[model samples]
Target chain A: MAPVSLVSLGKAFGSIEAVRDIDLEIADNEFVVLVGPSGCGKSTTLRMIAGLETISRGELRIGETVVNHLSPGERDIAMVFQNYALYPHMNVAQNIAFGLRHRNLSRAEIKAAVLDAARLLDIEALLDRRPKALSGGQRQRVAMGRAIVRRPKVFLFDEPLSNLDAKLRAQMRIEIKRLHQRVPTTTIFVTHDQVEAMTMADRVVVMNNGVIEQVGTPLDVYNKPATRFVAEFIGSPSMNFFDGTLEAQGEDLVFRIGNGRALPVPRARGSAYSKHFGKRLTLGLRPEALSVSDASDFTIEVETKVVEPLGVETIVYFDLAGHPASVRAAPNRAPRAGETVPLSFDMTFMHLIDPEDGSVIPY
Target chain B: MVSRGGILANVATYAAAVLIAAFFLVPLTWLVSLALRTPQEIFFGASRFIPENPTLDNFGQVLRDRGFLNYLWNALKLSGLGALGSVIVAAPAAYAFSRFDFRGRGVMMMAILAVQMVSGLVILIPLYRYMGWLGLLETHVGVIAIYIAIGLPITVWLLKTAFDGVPIVLEEAAAIDGYGHFETFLRITLPLASPGMASALILNMILNWSQFLVPFIMLSRDAQWPISVAIYNYAGSTTASTTHLLAAACLITILPAILAFLLLQRAIVSALTAGAIKG
Candidate 1:
């Protein structure tokens, strides 16, 4: 296993830059996930690391050696594609043993490796089946077996779990994590699913428009998103934003919404936001941070627009001073559509963002 | 609950299918009947669909002709070698067209397809002069070379479509698996595209087997004449007197092609439909 380093790595297709010069250093045995929406360049960065795409600028190092000019095989990287990409003509044993063809190994060694991979993937019984005969999950496991059988320097995954159903995706997610724990291979997984990123990655690198927005541990990025995009993207149901200005009302400060509703800034946060008084800003609040039972400094009555009861918790979409907002409340406490309900914004977890640049205002 | 309109549509579809089938089948049936009939029945008897006095005498006569055996060997050698050579030459070129995203790829593919539109008849005299200048006239090598050129464009196009059905990700996976370009092609891409290659080989073989103008113009020696040229010569030399033998010879010339199609129809159909069904 090797630590992968992308030093100002960039990729350009004619005039369009698919991946901007982005620098990242992944520790050996770290499971770093590059997560974003489609066209965010997550896959491009992963492919560049895998040597599938040429890096137009900067250097890439794997295990302290510059690998920018090396081929994928020479760099010793194994990748699992979004579609699994198993050879349709080969059975499971052959598929897993295919990578070993170029190596100087005896037939018994190849057979043992294949059997070991099959055992690790719990696919021992499927060693004789062709890919067409396998289920989606089985195919995914076979793809995994093909990669891990080689024991390459770095494992690259390009949205490997995207093709499975939700239930299977979750199961495979745990299996991948468990496999990593067992082998501790340095892996770079590219996916657009934030949940997968949060659950599986040691660190999540959030990207947007070919640029990395944030790179931190899952909890770090979730609890303290570096930018407004991360604040919305990392959380479920997304964080709601209010467009208004921070107004100083005599002795205290209050955030004035578009419809003239003033949410009082807590005394503890008065000094932190006092400098931005009378300037237009955006307030970011996650769905889970707004509650129906708790009372806080920014409590307001809203007209509920829609209520989605998700078994454990209910998400209520409402209008907060002319801006759309959502809050997570207990299933029994959720109000019906068109009903007026009081939601207390937990300012402790509130994020004050600068409206001009979509960056969170440092407090 | 089928509707009345649906029933009418089904009837119309069946009628159209039957008409198309008859259009092709009637000639084959007539050829077979003539081949089985006596010379008198063909020349003097009433025009009937079925032969009253059927016999294998014509087939026996055609097979007994010493020249026919030489013609059959020449035809098999040319067709088999031409088909095999065309597939071997076209595979790598088709793989490049299918997999690589180089400049002028679209233009090159269009150019190859454009070659298909020009028939051998259009350049028959020029081809003869060129073959003579190369001192390859009246030779089997010259004729097979021309057959390969004639088969290249369609063979490349068909094989390219087949190669397109293979996912590029498989190649990338192979690349990561430590296989080089030639090895990856031989082990992964080639095996996956075998159905398309099979169809291309069979199609080229059939086309070369029925090739008439090329060998007819290039070769004057009866020993080197393929089945098509020999049949044409036979028909010309004994137009009325040996009509039954001529028909029997024509049927023999086409039997291999018909048998090949019957044996490998699934491969041809699957190769053609693979790209259509693939998402």
Candidate 2:
């Protein structure tokens, strides 16, 4: 497999830019995921790589050659669509062997290749059944088999697991990741699901409004998300943000929310916030980053709203200085709704974002 | 919890449905009774729904006549060939209409609808003159060509609609699998839209099989006359004034059309328009 690279690739439908001039280079055998909200151009970029949609501007290179002018057939890439796109009229075996038929492969060669794929995908017994007869997961495997039989230079997946139910989605997600590990083709997978991105990708490319927000490893982006968009978008039960101002209270760097409630920006991150003394900023804290604290160590007092008991750990929802926020706590320690509680940030996990631009405040 | 009003509404609905069925079925039952009767019974004796001595003699006579057989063959050839030719021409054309965004796609679609929009009678004389200029009159080929022209617009429109319903993603999938647009169309789009194509073919056959005007205008020569034209001429023939013989020939001509309707009536109706509207 060869590397796929995009240099300032941009696509526009008339005046509306679907994808802005974006740059990315996917290394050979890497599983890179483009994760974003819908209409953020992740699918558009994957389609551009597959030669399904035209690259309106900038360069697209699959392997060593520029493929902007190439047709999908000439580009030598296989795509797994969200709906699985198995030809309804063909049986499973024919569907898997479809791509190879166009090549100069012999009959025996095609059969062997198809059987190999069917076996690899655990669909050997289903080769005779038409797509309508198979379950959704089976059809998806057939789709993957179709792609794998081609053994193309690049593999593009556009929300491939979106159609399956939650349990099946989780199962197929592992199967896809496992398939990638075995095959290791230069793969560009696009999905709006951040969990899929975090679980499967070697690198996650976060995007919003047709522009790339950040590109890094899943943990790198998760731990130090470069923008507010990426920071909140990457985690479940999304990170909470409080609109506030940063001011120096002598030795303490205090964040003052409305109603004169001030939370100290832990002394460890003092060097980072020392430069933004009186500037307006947004403080972000995940549910896990906040812990039930005593009044002496408390950042602020919050009135509890709803307590969700999740067996292992209960999630306490409360209004933190008029903004909705949650705190991770033990089930026994979780406070009841309408009761006020003291909470403090884990400090090392806090995300301070610039409201003027949405970029994360650098430490 | 049976409401009096609800029971009355159900009874009224069923009674209306039966009335409508009888309204259509009465003529068909009358036709069968007429075809079974002897010439004496039809022309002079009491006109009854059931004959005193019901006979298949009229059917035997109609089937035995060489002219009648020739007419039947010509009609079958014209309609069958016309339907096949129309589908063959329309499949790719419809696929193009469905998938491609050419410079004149909207204009072309408008033109297809325009063909159906304009009354055939309005263009009949011109079509006749055009066919005459080509010396295409008085032949089965000429009549079939006319049938194709009449069927082409709707066939293309309906098939295009069906092709539209087959997701373009399948074609894209085929392309990624190393097939060209043509192969994708043939193996993917065409097979997926088979129901629509079959509907178009059956509808075209039914249309051409029963067409009285186009065939009547084109195939004036006795050797090339389809059963529809022959039946039309039979109404004017002095030798076939006997009601039983006339009814028998009429039954023969309409039999294929009735059977076509019975077999693919839903197919024809469901594929009337393109995509979401399904007109």
Candidate 3:
């Protein structure tokens, strides 16, 4: 396996830029996930690295050799496409052995390699069956098996599990993670699902609007997001944002919400928002960061609109002075609709962003 | 209860369908009856739906006396070669036009469509002079080449539609698995397009087989003539009467195309509908 690096890469189709100035370094034997919403250029960046797309500008290197001008075949990479594009005419064994046939291997070696990959993927009994005859999960294994037999320096996956049912997607996600653990190639996976990125990545690169938003470990991004987009996108039920003003109150800075509720700012955030006093800012709080308690230092009275019972936990949807907000609470203590609930804010996890530019205020 | 207008509409639909079917089948049925009638009956009898005395004498006479077998062979050779040659040349060009974005792709596609729009008869003089200058004027090669040129524009258009139906993901998978663009075309794209290619070949063969004007203008020698030109000779020759000329030669000339269509009907239907419901 080889480490790959892309420097200032960009791709444009006429006047529209699909990807812009992306620079990333993927270390050898690391599992990196590129996560973003649709049209955010995560897939485009991966295709550029795979050489399936032309780089409008910048350079790509694989282990010290520039590969921008090389074709996908010469770049020594294998890609598992979103649709699992198995050749409809070929059976499982034939599909797995196709890439090896062009190599200088003998028939026996090719057969051994295919059998080994099939066995690794636990698809040994499916070797004789065509792709159409297999289930979706079986077809996914075959797609992976086809890539494994080539044993390239890098493996690129473009939302390979998006077509499967939920249960099968979870199963195949584990299967792909386990396969990477076994082979340990430098792998780059692209997905619009942040859960997949959080669960499977050694390093997750969050992208938005054709640019990299943040790159860090899963916990690093969750606990300390560099931008409001990352903070909002990385969690379920999304982080809630309240437009407010940062002001000095008795020698301490506090964010005053619209209903005259004010929460003291954390000390770590003071340096970031020091110059933004008397200016508009956005306060981001994750659903888990807000707890339901009777006695707390700061509380926001919210009228519950809806309650969703999720067995272990319940999501309480309510209006915080007419602004929408949701809180995660114990299922047994979940509040009823139209009931007023006192929500205690966890200021330690509070995030502050500049309302004008949507950039996170450093602290 | 159903309305009177709805019942009348149903009756009218059935009547229209039957009328269209009869319109297509009547000429073929008449041709068959004419082929079976004797020369005397055809000349003297009333114009009837059925023959008074059916016989195989016209078929036998044409086969034995008129060198019909040689003409049939010439037509088959020319049409078969022309269809195969046109498909082989057009398939690659069609693939390029369908898949690639080159500098003059739109202009090139428009040029092909423009070629199809021009009538072959209007270019007869220029084509004839070009063939004469190349010393291919009276040969089967000259006729076959002209047929290929005439059939190419539409053949490319048909095959290009076929190639465009194949998903780009399949080709990209092949490319990442070490196949080049041409290799991917040969391995993935062509197999998916087999039905369309077969349909295009069948269509072009029918067009070239029944072609009359180009061969009529290009070839001067009887020995090198295709069935179309040979049938024209029967129309002018004194040995065969008009009734015999129409019955025997027409039936013989149409048999191969009918057989080809019968063999490829299923593929043709599927090829026509393959791109209708793509995912």
Interface Cα root-mean-square deviation for all models: 0.7, 0.6, 0.7
Q: Clashing residue pairs in candidate 1, if any?
A: none
* lDDT (tens digit, per residue) of candidate 2 on B213-276: 8887877688788898887666776343456777788888888888888888887778874455
lDDT of 3 by residue, B1-279 (tens): 879999999999999999999997887777778778877667643476587788888877877854677878888888889998899989989999999889999899889989999998898899888999999988888888888888899888889889997888999989888899888999999998877998988888888889888877877777767787788777676443467556767787787888877888777666656567764
Among incorrect, acceptable, medium and high, the docking class of model 1 is high
lDDT at B102 for candidate 1? 98
Q: Name the lDDT value of residue B178 in candidate 1.
A: 81
Candidate 1 residues B40-147, lDDT tens each?
788753476588889998999999989998899999999889989889999889999998899999999999999999988999999999999999999999998998
Q: How well is candidate 1 docked (DockQ)?
A: 0.86
Which window of ten consecutive residues has the lowest lDDT sum in model 1 chain A? Answer: A292-301
Candidate 1: regions farther than 4 A off: A294-298, B1-23, B239-241, B269-279
Please list all clashing residue pairs in model 3, or write none if there are none: none
By DockQ rank, best first, the candidates go 2, 1, 3
The lDDT of model 3 is: 0.88
* lDDT per residue as tens, model 2, A92-194: 9999888998799999999999999888899999999999999999999999999999898999999999999999999999999999988889888999999
The clash numbers for all candidates, in the given order, read 0, 0, 0
Clashes of 2: 0
Tell me the spans in candidate 3 whose CA falls farther than 4 Å from its real position: A267-275, A295-297, B1-7, B43-48, B56-66, B237-246, B269-279
